[model samples]
Target chain A: MQKVVKSFGANTVLNALDLDIAKGEIVSLIGPSGSGKSTLLRCINLLEPIDDGEIWFGGIDISVPGYDPNPVRRRIGMVFQSYNLFPHMSVMENICLAPVRVLGRKANDTKAQALALLEQFGLADKAKSYPDQLSGGQQQRVAIVRALTIEPEVLLLDEITSALDPELVGEVLDAVRNLRNTGMTVVLATHEMSFAREISDTVCMLDGGVIIEKGSPESIFTNATNPRTRQFLSRVNSR
Target chain B: MIATVSTLAVAITLIVAIPKMPRWDRVKKSFFNGEVLGETFPKLLDAFVLDIKIFLWSVPIILFIAMLVAVTRNSRSPALFPLRILAVVYVDVMRGVPVLLWIYLIGFGVPGLGLERPWNSPLLWGTVALVLTYATYVSEVFRAGIESVHESQRAAARSLGLSNAQTMRHVVLPQAVRRVIPPLMNDMVSLQKDVALVSLIGPIEILRQAGIDKSKFASFTPYVGAAIIFLAITIPMTRTTDWLLERERRRTSGTRVS
Candidate 1:
C-alpha cells in the first residue's frame, strides 16, 4: 500500500500513508486511539475505500477506482472489535455462511470443513450454539474462524480483543497465536502490548495517520528512537 | 373488590342516565332498537364476507409489495438511486393520500377508462387501491426493521466477501424480518380494519350494506351491527398482536446482543 488517503467529511482519518507486508509475516500496528490503525487495516480489506493511492495485494492494484472490490475482499478477511456474529445463526451457520452463500460451496463439504476447524480450535461443542450463548472470548474466536473459513491470503484483525473481558482476552489471543504458528499472513491493530511483542515479526508505531516508527519488536520496544514513541510506550507501560 | 364496585357503579349510572335523556326514545329507536338490529344484522354479516374477501386478497399483495419497496429504499448502491427515489415517492404519495381517496381515484378512475371485463370491476380496483396504499404504511414498518439492524452487521458480512445482495439475503433480512414480525402483524391488523374503506367506492361490503339497511328500515341499527362485526375480527387480531409483541420482546431480550 502506497500514499493511501482516507477522509470522512472534513476529518482525514488516514493521511497520505505508505506501508508494505510480506507473505507469511505477522505485522502488528500499535497506536493510540484515533491514530488510524483501524482505518489502515480497513483500507487493506477494502472495507473503507481509500481516497487516494495504490493498494497492491499479490499483483492487483485493488485501490484503483472501478476495480471490483469483492474479489480482493474475498482474499483478505477481517475480524472487527465487536464480534459481529450473525446472532440469529448457530456458530456452524456463521462459519459456513460466506462459503455457501458467497463462494457457492457445497453445504456438506463446507460443514465438514467447519467442524474440523472447530475441533482444531476447541469450539466443536459450541457449533450448535448461537453467539449470545457464548462468552465474549468464544464469540470473538468464532468470528476469527468465520473469517478464516474462506481461506483468505491475509487476515486483518481490527482490535479483535478490545471487547473481551480481561480474563477472557488470553483465550482469544491464544487463537491468534495458533494462526501465527501456521505462518498465516496476519495484520492486526491491537492494544495487547505483550502479545504483539511476542507474535509480531514487525511492529509499527503509528501516530497522527502515519507510522512514526517501524522495526523489530526488540528494537522498537527496548531501544526506541522517537520521543513520541518513547512517550507512548511509557504511558502504556505505566498502565 | 373496589374494581368490581366501580365497574357496577359506572354500568348502573349509564343505564339510569341514558334513559332519562329527552331524546333517549328517539335515539334508541334510531340506533339500538332490537327488532331493527335483528332484521339488519344478517345482511351486514353477509356483506362482511366481501370485506373478509378483500382483506384476504390484499394481505399477501400488501406484504410482498411492502417488502419490495422497503428493500428498494434501503439500498445504498449509487446505481439504484433512481429506483430508491421512486420508492421514496411511492411511500410518500401513497401514505399522504387518504385510503378512501385512493379508492375513489382507482376504483372510480380506472373503470372510467373503459377497460373491459374484470379489469374494470370495482372489486378489483378497490382491492388494488387498498393494497397500494396499505403497502406504503407497511413498508415503513419494514423499513424500521431493516434500519434497526446495526451497521456493524453489514460491515461483518461485507468483510467476509459477501456481495450486498447476498449479505441482505443471507444475513440482514433474516434478522431484520425477525425483529419486525410484531410490527408487521400490527400493520396487518390495521389493514384488516381499513379494508372497509373499499365499501365507499362500490363493493357492497359491511359499511355499504349498513347504509342499505338503514334506508330500508329507516333506522340506524345496521351501522352498529357493522361496528360489532368489525370489532369481532379486529379484537382477536389486536390481542394476537399483543401476544406476538410480548413473545418477541422476551426472545430478543434473552438472546440478542449488540
Candidate 2:
C-alpha cells in the first residue's frame, strides 16, 4: 500500500501511509488502539477500501478503481480478530468452503487437502466438529488453515490473538510462527510487542494514522529513532 | 333433543363398531356397495386434489413476493421507511381479518370491476387471496431469518470477494434460513390448514365436500371421517417438524460445548 488515505467522515484513520512488504517477509504492524494498524491491514485485502493509494499485490494494481478484485483476493487471505469461521460448517468444511466455491475444486479433492492442513495444525481430530465446539485458539488455527487452504500467496492477520485468553494466545502465535517459518508472506497487526519483536523481521510503529518509524525489529525495538515510537512501544510493552 | 340424541348415538356406534368389527368380505362389500360412502370418497378425493392444486400454485408466488418485501424492508435506501410501514400494515391487516373475508372480497368484489377471463376465474381469485394473505406472514418470517444472521458474517463474506447478492445467497442466507426452519415449517403447516378456508367461495375443497356430504347423507359420519383424515395427514407432518427442530437445536447446542 502506497500513499493510502482513508477517513470515516471527518476523522481520518489512515493518512498517506506508504508500506511495501516483500514476498516471504513477516512484517508486524504495532500501534495503540485506533491508530490505523488494523485499518491498514484491512486495506491490503481491500476489506476497507483506500480513499487514495495504490495496493499492488502479485502484479495486480488494486489501487485502480473498479478493478475486478476476486482474482487478486484469491492470492490474499485474511484472518480477523474474531476468527470468522462459518459456524454452520464443520472445521473441515470451513477450510474447504472457499476452495470448492471460489476455486471450483472437487469435494473429494478439497476434503483431502483440508484434512492435510488440519492434521498439520494438529487439529485432524477436530475435522468433523463445528467451530463453536473448538476453543478460541483452536478456532483461530482452523481459521488460519481455512485461509491457507485456498493457497493464498499473502496472509493477513488482524489482531488474531486479541480475542484469545492469555493462556491460549501462545498456541495461536505458535501456529502463526510456524506459517512464517514455512515461507508464507505474513502481515500482522498486533498489540503483543514482545511477540512482534520475536517473530517479525520488520516492525513498523504507527501513530495518528501515520507510520512514525519503520525498521528491522532490532532497530525499532532497541534503537527507535522517533520519540513517539518509543512512547508507544513503552505503553504497549508495559501493558 | 331427538336430533342431539341421534347424533350422539351415531357417533358412539361408529366409534365402537368401526374398529371392533371383524374383517370380513361381507362388511367390505357392504361399504363398497353403499351409495353414500361411494359418493363421499370421490367428492373427498376431488376436494383434496383441488386443495393441493391451489396450494402448489399459491406457495411459489407468495414466496417470491414475500422475499421481495423482506429485502426491501431491510434495504438502506431512503424509501425503506415507507416500505417498512407498508409491509407492517399489510401483515397486520391480512393477519387481523379472517381469510374467508379476503376470499369473499377478492372473489366476489373483484369480478364486479369487469376484469378479463383469467382474473374472473374462481381458482385465480381464491389463489390470489391465499397468496396475498400468506405472503405478508411469510415476509415477516423471512425478515426475521435475514436479521438473525450476524453483521460480521456479511463483512466476512464481502472480504472474501463475494458481492452482496452472492453473500446473501451463499453465506448469510444459508445460515439464516437454517436458523428459521422451525418457524418456516410452522408457517407451511398453517398454510395447509388455511387452504380449508377457500371452500367458503364455493370451491369444492375438502371441508366443502365434507359439508356437502353431511347435508346429503342426513348423517355426520362423513364429516367426522374427513376430520379423521385431516388429523392423519397433519399429525405426522407436525411430528416430523418437531423432530427436525429438535435435531437442529441439539446440533447447535452440542457445538457450543467446547
Candidate 3:
C-alpha cells in the first residue's frame, strides 16, 4: 500500500500512509486509542474503499475504480476485535462456511480440513459447540481458523484478543504465535505492547494517522528516535 | 385466598347475569341453536378446505416477497438507490392500505378487466391482494430482524471475502430469521383468519359458506359454528406462538434479539 488515504468527511483518519509488508514477516501496528491502526488494516483488506492510493497485491492494483474487492479479499483474511462468529452456526460450521461458499470446496472435504485445523488450535472438543458455549479464547481461535481456511496470502489481526479476559488472552496469542512458524505473512493492530515486542519483526508506531517511526521492536521500544514515539511509549509503559 | 375469591366472583357474575338478560331466550335461539350448529358443522368444515388451500399457497409467496423486499430495503450500495426507493414505496403503500380493501379492489376489480379464464378468476386476484398486503408487514418484521444483527457481523463476513449476497445467505438471514420466528408466526395467525376474506370476492370459503347457511336457516348459529372452526386452528397457533415466546423469554431472561 502506497500513499493510502482514508477519511470520514472532515476527519482524516489515514493521511497518505505507505506500508510495505514482506512475504513471510510479522508486522505489528501500535498506536493510541484514536489512531488509524484499525483503519489501515481495513484498507489493506479492501473492506473500506480507500479515498486515494494504490494497493498492489500479487502484481495487481486492487484499488482501481469499480474494482471488485471480493477476489482481493479472498487472498487476505482478517479477524476482528470481537470474534464475529455466526452464533446461529456451530464452531465447525463457522469454520466451514467460507471454505464452502467462497472457495467452492466440497462440503465433506472442507469439514475434514476444518476438523484438523480445530485439532491444531486445541479446540477439537469444541467442534460441535456454539460460540456462546465456548470461552472467549476458544471463540477467537475459531475465528482465526475461519480466516485461515480461505488460504489467504496475508492475515490481518485487528486486536484479536482485546475482548478476552486476562487469563484467556494467552491462549489466543499462542495460536497466533503458532501461525508464525508456517511462514504466513501476518499484520496486526494491537494494544498489547509486550506481546508486540515479543513477536513483531517490525513495529510501526502510528500517531495522527501516519507512521511516525517504524523499526525493530528493540529500536522502537527502547532506543526510540521520535519525540511522539517516546511520549506514546511512556504512556503505554506507565499503564 | 383473594385470587380464588375474585376468580369465582367474576365467573359467577357472568354466568348469572348473562342468562338473566331480557332477551336471553331469543339470543339462545339465534346464536346457540344446537340444531343449526350440528347441521352446518360439516359443510362449514368442507368449505374451510378452500381457506386452507389459499393459505398454503399464499404463505410461501408472502415469505418470498417479504424476504426480497427486506433485503432490497436494507441495501447500502448507491447503485441500488432506485431499487431501494421502489422497495420503500411498495412497503409503505402495501402496509398503508387495509388488507380487506386490497382484497375487495383487486379481487372484484381485476376480474372486471375481462381477462382470460385463469387470469379472470377472483380466487387468483384475491390471493394476490392478500400476498401484497401481508408481505409488506412481514417484510417489516424481516427488516427488524436483519437490523437487529450487529454491524460487526457484516464486517466479519465481508472480511472473509463473501459478497453481499453470500453474506446475507450464509451469515445474516439465518440469524435474522431465527430472531423473528415468533413475530412471523403471529403474522401467520392473522393471515390464516384473513384467508377467509377472499370469500368476499367470490369463491365460497368457510365464512361465505356460513353466510349461506345463515340465510338458508334464517338463523345466526352457522356463524358461531364457523367461528368454532377458525378457532380450532387459530387457538392452537396462538398458543404455540405464546409458548415459543415464553420459552424464548425464559431462555434469555428477556428474549434478547441479539
For every prediction, compared with the true complex, DockQ reads: 0.59, 0.27, 0.48
Better of 1 and 3 by lDDT: 3
Looking at model 2, residue A127 earns an lDDT score of: 92
* Residue A105 lDDT (model 2): 88
Compose the digit string of candidate 3's lDDT tens values, residues B28-128. 99999999999999999999999999999999999999999999999989999999999999998889989999999999899999899989999999999
Model 1 chain A, TM-score vs. native: 0.96
Candidates sorted by lDDT, best first = 3, 1, 2
Fraction of the native A-B contacts that model 2 recovers: 0.22
Q: What would the per-residue lDDT of candidate 2 be over residues A18-53, giving only the tens digit for each residue?
A: 888999999999988999998898788777767887
TM-score sort, best first: 3, 1, 2
Cα RMSD (Å) per model?
A: 2.8, 8.4, 2.9
Tell me which residue pairs clash in candidate 1: none
The residue pairs that clash in candidate 3, if any, are none
Superior candidate under DockQ, 1 versus 3:
1
Weakest 10 consecutive residues of candidate 2 chain A by summed lDDT: A167-176
Winner by lDDT between candidate 2 and candidate 1: 1
